[model samples]
Target: MATEIATLGGGCFWCTEAVFQQLNGVLEVESGYTGGQVANPSYEQICEGTTGHAEVARLTFDPAVVSYREILEVFFTIHDPTTLNRQGNDVGTQYRSVIYYHSPEQQETAKHVISEMANVWDAPIVTELSPAETFYKAENYHQNYFRQNPLQGYCAFVVAPKVSKFRKTFSDKLKQF
Candidate 1:
């Protein structure tokens, strides 16, 4: 089956990865750092916000089963796009709302989605639409963190709430866990 990849950053990679993992057509959700100047930034480097990288999740999905538009729909619904370089309590460029489009088509889609969201809300869309860059996978401990540490304090208090919201809001697109 033909597949496409979409990389996005809306806040903590844990939250983005967790939300995308539940989608029916998504094959994998890898937490990573992208849109940065560093060759291979570690999580710590990114956290400092000097690398210019955003904590992102690369999603591999079956396009036939879930359109790019649908993916963006879920993305926009999951996080605030109005705040520049921030999401909820997470502040700094690393937590910025961004879409690292893998192709020209993806870039166009990202722009379209942002415009649509702008119409939906009076606030301008601060979500960055840019070409995809080298993605450095986060440290091993960060991958599938929600699945691996469901009861961890941050997982329970932060990630779990976002996952619940995504699952409930996009029930039709969720995969059976």
Candidate 2:
């Protein structure tokens, strides 16, 4: 089995973690903080938007079952990459749309996907494509927030919709439960 990692930030980590968890090849989705100078940034520090860290979901997957391009395609679909430093009502640099690629190939694939997705959206794509950085895992409460608190207000109104869209659009890619 070939294992690969993909670190992505698209607004809230809760939303991104929920969406990727349903994918077939994704082994695990860890909510984390990255692309920042802080060694171990707390969620509070991230929320302040001064740590430069974006709330991210680091995914472990098998390339044989899912390609990096496919992961990126779903990412672009679930979040508004055109919006800078925001997704829905969530605002701040920590909520910025970003792709922290693990390899040269992943970086190229992200660039290609971003370009292709630009035609799909009306505004310019502002999603950042950077090399993978030190990922500080988020607090345990955030690990599986959507799954643990589906009825939570933000999860119900925001994360749930993104998960629903991912399910509807990528039904064929879903894992058998």
Candidate No. with top lDDT: 2
In candidate 2, which residue ranges exceed 4 Å CA deviation?
none
C-alpha lDDT score of every prediction, in listed order: 0.92, 0.95
- TM-score for all models, in order of appearance: 0.96, 0.99
lDDT (Cα, 0-100) at 58 in candidate 2? 99
What are the clashing pairs of model 2?
none
Candidate 2 accuracy as lDDT: 0.95
| lDDT tens per residue, model 1, 1-177 | 999999999899999999999999999999999998999888889889999999999999999889999999999988889988998889999999999998999988888888889888668889988889899999999999999999998889889999999988999888987
lDDT of 2 at 37: 88
Q: Write the per-residue lDDT of candidate 2 for residues 1-177, one digit (tens) a residue.
A: 879999999999999999999999999999999999888989889999999999999999999999999999999999999899999899999999999999999999998888898889999999999999999999999999999999999999999989999999999999999
Q: Quick one: RMSD of model 2?
A: 0.6
Report the number of backbone clashes for model 1. Answer: 0
Lowest-sum lDDT 10-residue window in model 2: 110-119
